[model samples]
Target: MIGLNHYLIISGLLFAIGLMGVVRRKNLLMLFFSTEIMLNAANIALAAAGHFYNDLSGQMFAFFVIAIAASEVAVGLGLLILIYKKNGTLDLDDLATMKG
Candidate 1:
């Protein structure tokens, strides 16, 4: 049967992958995606724990995390697009030169 341990392990793996993406990627868009992955990992873990413990709080928190993630992706991508249009590149290093 699927259990809390399984969920936690998956969550840990997801978080690790996300962390790697965030640390190793140079594109601003990829960094945003990595952050979303990390957020999703936390949500899954929270939801799993809620189910395992028969408590609703964890699930509620997970929902909030999802909402926040959605908003982040929207605003973050918008900013990335603006940067790319202005700089002609999505590379994080390129963005650093933004002086306006």
Candidate 2:
């Protein structure tokens, strides 16, 4: 039967993938996507722990994480759009070289 261990393993794997993306990606949009993936992994682990413990705290925290992720996406996307409009590109390296 599936258990907490299984969910935890999946979450770990997802978090690792997201971490790799965050480390290796250069584009702003992809970095945001990677962060979202990491947040979702945390949510999965939290929800699984709550279920296994038969307590509501972990679930409640997971909900909070979800809300935070939503807000991040909203603000990050708006900023990304503005950045793209001003620079015409989302490459971090390119942006870093530009003079203010």
Candidate 3:
């Protein structure tokens, strides 16, 4: 039967993929997506552990994480849009070289 270990393994794999994306991606949007993936992976692990322990705290923390991710996306996207409009590109290297 599926258990916490199985869920944890899946979560770990997803987090690793997200980490790799964060390391390898160069586009601003892709970086945001990678961070979201990482957050979701953490949520999965937290929810699974909470279920295993029959406790609400981990699940509650996961909910908070989701809320934070939502806010982050809202603000991050706004900044990205402004940056793209000002710079005309979302490439990390290009953005890095930008100066006032």
Candidate 4:
């Protein structure tokens, strides 16, 4: 049967991929997507652990994480929109001019 180990392995792999994406991508939008991916990986792992242990605690914690992630996305996207309005591009290097 599918087990906690399998779930953990998959979660770790997904988190690594997300981290690599965040590190490699230059676009701010893609960076946000990568962060979302990492959050999802955590969710998967938490849910799996909750199920394997026959407890609701982990699941509830995952839900809280989901809520926080959703809020983060909302605020992040709003800022992105503002940034896009102020600047014509979303490139990280292009944003360097904003710093002192």
Instruction: Give the Cα lDDT of each candidate.
Output: 0.91, 0.95, 0.96, 0.95
| lDDT of candidate 1 over 1-100, digit per residue (tens) | 8889999999999999999999999988788889989999999999999999999999999989989888988888898888888889888777565577
**Model 1 segments more than 4 A misplaced:** 98-100
What clash pairs does model 3 have?
none
Deviation (Å) of 35 in candidate 2: 0.8
Weakest ten-residue segment in model 4 by summed lDDT: 91-100
lDDT of 3 by residue, 1-100 (tens): 9999999999999999999999999999999999999999999999999999999998999989999999999999999999999999999989666576
Q: How do the candidates rank by lDDT, highest first? A: 3, 2, 4, 1
1-99 in candidate 2: lDDT tens per residue?
A: 999999999999999999999999999999999999999999999999999999999999999999999998999999999999999999999888657
Give TM per candidate: 0.90, 0.92, 0.94, 0.93
Off by over 4 Å in 4: 98-100
> How big is the positional error of residue 12 in model 1, measured in Å on the Cα after superposition?
0.5
* Model 3 quality (TM-score): 0.94
The number of the candidate with the highest TM-score is: 3
Model 4, 16: alpha-carbon shift in Å?
A: 0.6
**Candidate number that wins on TM-score, 3 or 4:** 3
